[model samples]
Target chain A: MNWKRYERASDLNGALTLLDRAEGTGRVIAGGTDLVLQLGQRQKSAELLVDVTGIDELRGLCASGAWIRIGAAVTHREAAASGLLREEAAVLAEGCGMVGSPQIRNIATLMGNVITAQPAADAAVPLTALGAELRVVSAAGERWVPLEEAYRGVGESAIDATREVATEIRFRRPGAGAKTRFFRLARRKALALPVLNGAVCLWRDGDAGRIREARIALGPVAARPFRARQAEACLTSDRITAALLEEAARLAAGEATPRTSLIRGSEEYRRAMIRLYLTRTLWEMLDIG
Target chain B: MDHGVKIRMKVNGQWREAETTPDRLLIDLLREEFGFTGTKKGCGEGECGACTVILNGRPLLACLIPAAKAEGADILTVEGLTPEQGLHPIQQAFQDEGAVQCGYCTPGMVMTAKALIDENPSPTEAEIKRAISGNICRCTGYTKIVAAIVRGAALLRGEAATTPAGVDRERVPQLPPVGPG
Candidate 1:
């Protein structure tokens, strides 16, 4: 409620300029679903709200060569409905489709979810598994930062919203022989935070019929989106087998460090779910019974 | 202190202008400035869809949107659905199907249904449930609300009332008033 001015930026430069002029008191407002709530609770304060939803260059969602770029203004609903994303990055599409609800999805931008930096953010979990990068811009210039490096802590993003704008999220499009899956266990289907959520991206060596690379991401289990490096290492260069899947799932469960949350669940329960969901996701990807 | 910003938006087919503060939520502007009280504010947060309204052809939580964001945009509220004389078909269907219990969630539910039917004229039952998942109806347990949306879709499609057996107008009994006469 302390916001004194609202300015809508027409382009990327304009947005950066507006933020530069605010002298670190201007915050970028895209969807405003999370930022508005934070501002209302006095969790955050801003002298000026530079609305970036109108920035033209920041609204692109297309594939360039090998990368798929999602603009900062791309809402969950738009990402969920994108045919390219559905075909190439279905895990992200599924994650976005499962966010708050249809109404929230229509306005909550993907970058906003990422910037909010909640460990269990639906979109952020999938983006982590996909190894996405953020394109950040400021008056000085622009730089591409890995998605994992963008988080400072729980509910904190490294990118200063008052001074910088996360222009877009870019990730390489999963090529042929690669598959991804996202799994979420929540108290209810909608309007509830996830008890445990995970995402996996696997690339198979077509000729050898072996796993070439794997990325397993889980959340609300750590301070940030957790990458199960041990589990991923176990799966890499390994043949698809029931025993290997079990070992990977177990490793993933071992890697998680979930805390007992009154809203989520007991730590033990979430750990068990990590193993269960990982196993299910791997089995489905490998076409196992 | 900063004074205020001038905003102009098309609300319910009428272009109106208003001076609003930067922090003013769209829901407050709709209710206080435009007198569109039909869009209730059950939960100020986005979890509840009681403040839902269609902005620029998409159904969004008005409580989460800043009034300045609505500048130059087109908005449709529950009040916008009414015709010159009669209730909109969606509202009529809700009444016919007995979807109104405490009547608090009705406006938001109706607006959500309007957006759904506008895009998908023949949405499946699952789609209907998914579309209104954001709306919380403590009364009627959502059975009657779901049935109302189904009937509303039919009415919008220009089909005859295919009221299901459970919500059949004849089958619903009239009860005595709660308060003493």
Candidate 2:
């Protein structure tokens, strides 16, 4: 609730210039659902707010041959309603929908969710599962960073907010006959942040139905959202069965090192849920449920 | 420091400009500056849905929105939903189905319900549950509220609301024509 001068940037270039000049003094505001709330709680402060909601290039989803591009400033509601996202990355859409509530989804941006780097960020798990990349724009130029490399801390991101404005998030769409599912173990039904959310994506490879790739992303368990590579490796063979899924779940459970927070989830409960959700999600994805 | 910033917001249907602090919450502006007090504030945090309003045709928690950020946005509160002519269908349905108990959560519930019906004209019980899941009601276990939304959808469909003798049946807008009736 501290005093700050707010200015609406005309375009992405304007925003980049403002960010470059102000260093840490200016913060980009899009949607403002999270940033405004954080400001009110005194979690973040700035001398100037560069509102970028009106920036055209920073909104909407675009699809190419294999890559799907999601604008950083696209609202969660837009992401939830995107048919391309639903077809290509349904988990991302469903996860975005589950954040906060319908109201928060209307104004909260995907970039904001990614930048917050909260371990419990619902959309982060799916992004990690899809191998999404962060496209950042600064006064100097543009660069791409993998989603996993973007996080540095629980609530901190490696992308310098002072110098960069996240412009796009891109990921490869799963090929033919691929199946993906997003599931979360939240305390309550709506508006509540995830206690421990996860995403599982598997693709078919030839006649054997290989798990071409599997991503086991866990949230609220570490400094940043992470994919359980050991678990993913366990299921990346031609043969995928209930036993293999159980093993993957067991491995995923071991990867998480959850800490106790005001939110009433313990390390024990989260680990259990990770294993439970992994098997359940695997079953649900394979239509063996 | 003169910390207040100038912002323009579309309250109901009118565009009004006001100078407010960068941190001024939306609930305070609705009640104090705009004088439309129908939107209540229960938990200052986003947990409670008492201060729900329609932002860009979608329901959102107004209490969590900063007044400065709502610039040039369309906001529809409970007061905005009702017309000078009469009550909106959601309001009538709440009255008809006896959904209001303490009448505190009604405004937020109405806004949330409006969003649900607007998006999905005939939402299933599960969808309705998901839509209002953010709204917490200490009284009225939400059975009647859900029923009221169903009844309101029927009313909007122009399917004869079956009102009592004294009610006017003409105020509610009719649903758009669809497949052969």
Q: Who wins the lDDT comparison?
A: 1
lDDT of 1 by residue, A8-117 (tens): 99988888888888898899999999999999999999999999988888788999999999999999999999999989999999999988899999989999999999
Q: Cα lDDT of all candidates, in order?
A: 0.90, 0.82
For model 2, state the Cα shift of residue A171 in Å: 0.7
Point out where model 1 deviates above 4 Å.
B164-181
Candidate 1, residue A188: how far the Cα is off, in Å: 0.8
Question: Interface RMSD of candidate 2?
Answer: 2.0
Tens-place lDDT per residue, model 2, B71-94, is: 788999999889799789888888
Per-residue C-alpha lDDT of model 1 across residues B1-181, encoded as one tens digit per residue: 3567788899999999888787788999999999999999998989879999999999999999999888999999988889889999899889888889899999999999999999999888899999999999888889888888888889899998675534566666889779977
DockQ of 1: 0.81
TM-score of the candidate numbered 1? Answer: 0.97
Worst ten-residue run, lDDT, model 2 chain A?
A1-10
- lDDT by residue (tens digit), candidate 2, A1-289: 4636666787998888887778788887777767776777788777778877778887768797789988877988889889988987888898998887777777788888899888888888789888899998888888999999999888888887766888889998786666778888777777677887888777777545677777778787888887899999998887777898899999989987886667846778778888998888887777553
